[model samples]
Target: MGRLATLAALHGVATVHSPGPDVAVPVPDETVVAVLAALGVDASTDEAVQDALTRAESAAASRLLPPTVVVWTTPDPGTSGAVLPPALPRALADLPPGTGLRVETERGDTVEWPSLDAPPTDAAAPGPVSAAPEGRSWPDLPLGVHRLAAVAADGRTAGAVLVVAPREVPQPPPRTHGFLVQLYSLLSTRSWGMGDLGDLAELATWSGRELGAGFVQINPLHAAVPGDPTDPSPYRPSSRRFPDPVHLRVEAVPEYAYVTGQGIALLDGLLERAAGLRAAVLDKGALIDRDAVWQLKREALEIVREVPLGPGRRAAYHHFLAEQGQALEDHATWCALAEVHGSEWRAWPSGLRDPRSAETGRARHELIDRVDFHSWLAWLTDEQLAAAGRAARDAGMAVGIVHDLAVGVHPDGADAWAQRDAFAEGMSVGAPPDAFNANGQDWGLPPWRPDVLAASGFAPYRGLLRGLLTHAGALRIDHVMGLFRLWWVPAGADPTRGTYVRYDAEAMLAVLVLEAYRAGAVVIGEDLGTVEPGVREELHRRGVLGTSVLWFERDWEGTGRPLAPESWREDCVATATTHDLPSTAARLTGEHVELRHRLGLLGRPLAEEQREESAEVADWLGTLTRLGLLPADGGDEEEQIRAVYRFLLRTPARMVGVWLPDAVGDRRPQNLPGTWDQYPNWRLPVADAEGRPMTLEELAASPRLHGLMSVLRPSVVN
Candidate 1:
């Protein structure tokens, strides 16, 4: 057991800390063994454990540095463009004197110290580190990823990727308020069954110009895994690298006007069908059918693809293809193959499962045309996303469009199949047992292997950030704590048996900050829920804004009372509700409890659940009444909703987000966490208090919405 423990520690696998503090229950030996196996270490038996431990220690001794080294440049004060000399990083400092070194900087410069006399000081910089130097003080190497080669005294040599980044991410210009919404739930009259990029553009334009919004934060639009019944949750997507084509507005395509003969007839037919599909959800109360909508759009797109691109358009397409490179090819190939085999790539033939295998290469040649079609879809989505961002900025938005980045990718999706080496096999990402659920949770998404990530200098992760930030003003990371650690559950095992696995948070943050920096984008960390104590502080120090939902912002350590607006953290986005929770109306009227009870999702007696929920609401209402945001009479139900936004304004938070559904007195949550088909998880359109879906035009003209927006002044202290 001791030998196994040492082996696990060397691999950064947690054998404890699941189910949390004060609990003496240790992680099972089997769980530790399974996690080790996933990391390519074998500790199945006592003899195996000792053997693995010996090999691990031997590797540690021989290794000069981790696969990656990150450094933050320290600028000297009271000097003209001067930087302090960097002290020896712990990794370099530990080596014997007279070691040889070579550095190839990003700016095509080189620095070599043959039989080093001195290039490093004895002191090291303090920050998130993996044997990082005490203080980053390299005057010669500018900010970028560089290469380093080291030769030890005894003739051993090692090479590592060196990263130089800024100390913090870009900060918001000033305090600003924005609308938070799930893009698909917001439908305009022109949309075909679900919201499209066109709808997003109009929403941003209207909100930025008329409603005085500074940003429009929307749910992730990452490409979905295609199947008969595609998963509707945007959080679980096929590839975070590409936007989903389902959200594209067909008519917006320039080639739509160029279509002739049979193509024009087919498009018209699809358009009429699309109108019927949209009417079903808005006028007939039917849930949003993502698969059906995709089918119609896919058919229409096939016809549009026949039209030849203009000279200028052709050039732009080639530019996009060149920039996207191999990543686009892999994603498109997966999509084309999925059309033949299925969405789940693991179920495909063994030869085809390996993306780089010779068989897969042969298959790619045969499916060349289909692959090109899918690649075109990605390009179209990219074009619309850029248009949406431009619309927001043109309408005089301050922060413009804010895009969400989900924590992980679907287990059997494009990213997992294409980048299998970077992801753990037979291990799924999840949460340890907490107050919410004793059994914990398995999200069914594969976690990126930290070993692979460091070895490659987090190249894949950096690429993902750049893609998302390309058209975003700000990027919000879902479950930002994941930058530090994630719970790993073995396949087919209970989530409760999972244990936490640590990542080099220093390297992760350096890559994130560097990429976002290059894009000139703000960063928001979704650090809600029971967070590890120092995680939020570290993020804040890096200029990453945290998410502060109203319901969860309490003085937990003290009286457990609602945290006063004045007391709220300034470096956060404050809001009354989010997609995962009840709308303002539902909380005020206790309709959420009723909805859950009706769906048989209640875990307790009806009266007991209602009483607990009611008490919680009463406490918050009392706080609001005292703050003068709520009137003593509280006459109209919608007035209470308006009052909630007013309260959010009182907080000194730099960014304020109003959940778009709450603007119209919506009574239902866009998502109900625990329920799947029993409740429509992500299908409902934005609706009014009576549960009637409202179109974008109606919503814009809604009296309830206007009244809510009126309370959202630029800076309302009181």
Candidate 2:
């Protein structure tokens, strides 16, 4: 390895291998240097590399502690397996004997330990090097993000974040089945052309109470960047912290009821348009047009805003403003400014580019009304989110409303603009060229700069998680491997030229565990593909459930055959399909291959793709038959679907997810990963096998949906 690579690795800016152990793919020197540059380290030359390496080593040696320390909570006092306090690392081992230690906990209480020389009983060094007396331990700390500071015997002082996390996050209540839907695609009769939070609440309540579902996991509902033709994909959102009010049910707002005069007339006109838009999708079989829906909702919301908030509602809005604080202000300011300038902050005039500039401050002052309007929208969005949660819980769901968190935010989105300092400039998060995407993918989303995140004690990450977990019974982290490392593709470069940028996994997981612990929520990590060797084990240790898809549960190293139900991992939310892949029905009938061919998305020859896809399906069918999951003569597609779910139930997985569309034999995928414009990605409504849109009422009345639900329910199935 070159000195530049050495420097990058030392600074946690490089990876030694691809995600899998089979490939020891070294990051190129140029990619390492570019990634280092993004981290503010100029390692462009040999001299620069040497200088950076020396500085990095010197800095590490000089620090009394790392920027952050994560300590696992001790579960029981009498247990031999109780977690030990974090040991002082080699960097701080040379501190003088009488170095004093103190901790200020999250609950505003202070605790002091005597000195490094006088450690408590039962202290054991976590590593080979022992500093204090053997079997010594630090003072007990309550679970939280505490402040830790050490005053050396020579009077030198240094501080670090002290994170106390539970050994593992709380497990799921039981092995229960739930519906999984794309919130926007699951439109109801009352929706304003597109599904909203009100529809989400209704889905949760009806599915949970009537169907006995334990949870409803939905796609990320993060804010979208407004535009003439807005991007409909929920995965690439403008802000992950605050939800989009475009998903809000306008009539649910209390002020909506009090609108008068011209406002009522304006809303009436918008409603008429909304009715047409809704009809276009439901009756005419047209795809859901998000921008059209948003346009009508925006006009209607303007009229609703004119109706002044009642005293109680006004107080609640102010409370939300105070709670969200500066983050919300920055987001609101960006939204307001986007109305005058554009959504892309970089294209704004130099004076307005910097959010904290004096000119920007002046502009914000002038646009205070618009800013307040955006803030009010955020408050309204939050209210509906809380209502959905309440609806889920009241409907008797265990882990109600499992919200999905996208890997990163859009390049020109509110989060990138608001938290500019935290994002690496001129770089995007993506994947290395793997078996799936030969050319690899550049997601075009900026990654959080690890150094900057550490400098801020991971406040940005903490806040993001906290916001998502606030209204979620569980949070599903998409591409959860990102918590350890991210592929950083330099600007204007192909994804193949990107290198892995390592993050402090310990600290990242610690923050996640801490937040989820506080929220009393379960966490599911989407560790589905190309994960490094230890990533899944670490996530499992921390009580984050893994995502296991039925199609991919094969023993690759051994038989390459479909894994038996008993062989499947227990710590997962097992499902037959995901948004990115084909629906179960499509997979069974090989319609996914036909769909790809129709869209010109097939990478190989049509016959080859069809044959290979057919063989894969047949293999799974053979397994089902051998295991007696299928009837002797082999059942129809719907029966096979039920058998596939039965195989899932036979596994020890804690949760089973039923793709809502699968209940009615929806064959089309909500998203096709490879093609953007080639397919109507993210625009399809929940439809049956023949691609007919199905409303909630229709779905409720469908015997097909009820039969599928019965398969999940043991009592009805028996």
For candidate 1, lDDT tens digit of each residue in 1-718? 4778889999999877835556645778899999888888999999999999999999888998777777765423333122332555566666666677777766566766564554432122212222225422233445667788889889889998887777788888668988999999989999999999999999999988888799999999999987668999999999999999999999999999999998888899999999999999999999999999999999999999999999999999999999999899999999999999998898999999999999999999999999999999999999999999999999988889999999999988999999999999999999887888777899999999999988877879988999999999999999999999999999999998888888989889988988887788999999976577689999998899999888888898899999998999999999988889999889989999999899987889999999999888888888888888788865467778777788888899999999998988898898898878888888999999888999999988887788888889633222
Each model's Cα RMSD: 4.0, 3.8
What candidate 1 gets wrong by more than 4 Å, as runs, is 18-21, 74-88, 106-109, 115-139, 714-718
The runs of at least 3 residues in candidate 2 whose Cα sits more than 4 Å from the true structure, single-residue gaps closed, are 19-22, 75-96, 118-137, 715-718
Q: Please give the distance, in angstroms, between residue 10's alpha carbon in candidate 1 and its true position after superposition.
A: 0.7
TM-score of each: 0.94, 0.95
What C-alpha lDDT values do all the predictions have?
A: 0.86, 0.86
Task: Show the colliding residue pairs in model 2.
Answer: 122-135, 123-135, 123-136
* TM-score of candidate 1 against the unseen true structure: 0.94
Q: How many clashing residue pairs, candidate 1?
A: 6
